[model samples]
Target: MTAPRLKVFSGNSNRPLAEEICQHIGMPLGEATVTSFPDGESFVKINENVRGHDVYIIQPTCTPTNQSLMELLIMIDAAKRASAHRITAVMPFYGYARQDRKDQPRVPITAKLVANLLVAAGANRILTMDLHSQQIQGFFDIPVDHLFASPVFFKYLEQFKGDNMVVVSPDVGGMKMAAAYAGILGAQLGMVWKKRTNATTVETVNVVGDVAGKDVLLVDDITETAGTLANAAKIMRDSGALSVRAAVSHALLSPIAYERLALGHIDELITTNSVPVDTRGLPIKVLSIASLMADAIVRINNNESVTSLFKIKGF
Candidate 1:
């Protein structure tokens, strides 16, 4: 059976990653005019005909969150109006995901709201990675291919694992991710108890597991202000950890985050280029997930199972 023609386009947020994905998949990126009007409203026009073609828009709602989100929505709407056979939003980093729940009164579940926005904009499918919470997938009625960056991390961290290594979670919220990394690396698991005094400050209260004389590797889904990672690394070192490192899926480094990491005890901050992050001479190493995303895209285009893309070698 012949497969439908596939086309991919990118928004302004992370065009490099999208282009890299297209390169790995052996396809040229689709042409589109995605710009903003003088009034700050998004304007999108598909340059080429997309009628009956399976169209995918690679737009991660990263920094300048509102602008990126609007661009994606407008592009999806444009694809629909162009009579595309299907429209998939491939978001490498989903913004506003931290607002997935309303633990307090008068708060909105913005994650679910984003999902609704994508659906309303005529997105036929979603391809995203390492959401703040996995349940965000259920927020969408469309088929969602949620890929993980663990395989990429594991592959890179293999050489760094040692005899007395311990995987630590920066906070209780990240215990699940830490456990997964620990299991894959065959290391001990630990956690740091933290209290958020403010949005920008995190106080490390205690260490939950044994880390004395062990090389510590902290894992988390994201890090913006670096408050949690910096604080946890300090406490772990004070508690007798021989070395400290962190592996975060998203490193949306702010000025505050960069300053903190520059002075913090963490020996390294390993992250993925899910968003645009520049180390600028800090102890930060970025691993590429473009290949992972490309493999998933190819499988999705073939209507084939994408489970194997998550597999790590020898584990």
Candidate 2:
């Protein structure tokens, strides 16, 4: 008995990351034609046969969220129609994730809707990283391999390990994530209490833990307008912290984010290449998760557990 062949394809969302993943996996990316018509309809045509093969489509629903999402669904449907044995939607940065719940009346749970759309489009499983909320995994009935970028961040953040370091969550909601980093780095934990003034503005009110004279490292799952992070950093700086930095999983930086980042509240911003991020000459460090994702893909194909991938040395 032989294992089914594994094939990886990518949409236009994050092609560079996909190419890097294929390079790490030592396989060529499966060819596909993903384009738009003049009428603005998404079209996907798999150039290679995937019959009885294990297929994975890499498409992060970022920037042009709707278009990227539609392309992924079409690609999945094409692979399903081609008789693929299994299909996995590889979304490095799951967009619409922040809308997992309805905080207001008459608001829809777009995260759940996206999950249903993927499953309806013939996705057998999902492989994604650093979702905005863990509960989003429950939105799907299919198997979900949720990988974290912590291990990668841990390796890069090793240099900052010291008694003077304090890990802080930009908001109360990210306290859990901040605690994990603090524990692994053997540092103190802290949090910022922030109120969302609007979709793109935030007001940081209070600090939960001590940051005085400590090198503060703020952690979060995502940042769009940079409001939460910037405000948190301002409060941390005003609180007598020696320095303030940030480690975010996804940097969906917008023009406003760039403007905020330019204010120089945070010293350094470390994040992953989960989505397309342009530094625009800011103090930002982008790490690659290609090897991390490629290893998971190979393990999944071989029916092996990916538990070890999450293990960080000295943690």
Candidate 3:
């Protein structure tokens, strides 16, 4: 294989993960300055020569969403102007994915809008993991390598699999993911019927499958408020579940979510380090995806197939 002239840069969103990935790949983090003006406008400058080099910008549009997003755009433009041969947006946690569809009248598909913005900003490709929905990939016309955190999640879960295990979806929408986990672990599949009363509140009406006296594993793509997962855990415990644990790809957990986790409604909250989570004072457990992401980046740089990254038996 030919050596890939690869370069990895990062924005302010998730610098620690980027640094870890760079370390895993045995490459120094690309030099770039990402800062904002007093008026909240983003400014970016590439400190090293990147002309004709294959560049990957690691930036997750997490908290302070707009500013981070703008920073990514500016960096992409900067790389393009510096004559980079290829530019890939490496977003571990894809934000604005919830606005993928027009569910209501006058609604905007901001996910699609973000895609357009990236393309317009001179990104040649995208590398992200565990989007809110699979269809969100269609929002982009460029090449997209969508990855899963299941490999990381499954590795951690392998230690806890037993005969009394049951994999559960926090809501009906996540049933498919739950079922896959169940099949892989040889556990029962269960789902909670959840009703969204508003933007922040969710009610678990009932459970669809048998979870009685079983160790429950609740799986979801992401969680922000922790309301849905916490409520589902309470309902499952009340319904005779022995223990309840949750595993999510992206945990953009709010302060309330941290409080809930501390209160112990859920047994274990296993998640990937896709975003910057402050687990210092919480009972949440985070698994590293640096090696997985680093491998994908290397493969992409070499023009190697990335299909195997998505082939989780239960996912």
Candidate 4:
């Protein structure tokens, strides 16, 4: 039997990234009308035929989180009702990921709720990159193909490879990610111990491992207010490090984050274009993951293994 025809569509959240993915895939984005009603309810209509076709919808739930997420769920429902053979929701940046668990009383596990919502809306599979926690995949009953942005970061970080480099995790929770980058770059590993003073504030209590006289590369899965990174960078500099930089997979830069970044604690902020980012004249470098995601989509469509994509040397 022949495979289902593949068709890709986009919601309003990240049309540019979706267009770039289609460009890399050598196909035009499937026609879809995604808009809102006067009362702000989302409306979606797949303009092209997708009956028995393999469909992929690209929409990252970034800022305006609820709206973007609703759009994705609606789009998935539309595809399901249209009789698509298989529908994969491609979320480059999964929002509500930080709320994976209920750390506080009377709080809900919003991440798990989001997963249940997606499955309920009829997503057959999920393709996302670098979730805040690896275990978010368990929230879904459907097959989840989680991709990493490390390959893209590794290629760009080749110039920084040297003996005097140290990969530092901004906090203890990210030590594993920092260790992976350290191994891949052949650098030393370090970590920061922090205490959360409030929802938007962080205090760095101590630093582990040697970073003096070394070029520090702080690695973390996400950053929003820049508090954690900025605080960590300040300590690294004060500790006599040559220079401090950060490699954050997702840069959810808010106005406060921009203000903090402008303070110049970190020399550079390297991030992926998983969401819309405005550098605002800061030393921020945004790398494209369009090609990487496009390659994964192709492999998935071909029923081939995507495990090889994670095989970075020493990682």
Residue 50, model 2: lDDT of 95
lDDT of 4 by residue, 135-208 (tens): 99999989999999999999889898899999999888999999999999999999999999998999999999
Task: Give the runs in model 3 whose Cα sits over 4 Å from its true position.
Answer: 1-4, 311-315
What's model 4's lDDT at 23?
98
**In candidate 2, residue 285 scores what lDDT?**
96
Measured by lDDT, the strongest candidate is: 2
RMSD of 2: 0.9
The lowest-lDDT stretch of 10 consecutive residues in candidate 4 is 306-315
- Model 2 poorest 10 in a row by lDDT: 1-10
Please, what is the whole-model Cα lDDT of each candidate in the order they appear? 0.92, 0.95, 0.90, 0.94
lDDT at position 135, candidate 3: 95
Clashing pairs in 3: none
List clashing residue pairs in candidate 4.
none
Tens digits of per-residue lDDT for model 1, 1-315: 666799999999999999999999999999999888899999988999999998999988988999999999999999999999999999999999999998899999999999999999999999999998999999999999999999999988998786699999998988889998998898999988889999999878889999999999999999999999999999888899999999999899999998999885999999998998899898899999999999988888888899999889966
Report the candidate with higher TM-score, 3 versus 4.
Answer: 4
lDDT of 3 by residue, 213-311 (tens): 899999999999999999999998889988889999999988788877777879889998899888866668999999999999999999999888766
Clashes of 4: 0
lDDT of 2 by residue, 1-315 (tens): 566899999999999999999999999998999999999999889999899999999999998999999999999999999999999999999989989998999999999999999999999999999999999999999999999999999999999999999999988789899889999999999989889888999988999999989999999999999999999999999999999999999999999999999999999999999998899899999999999999999999988899999999865
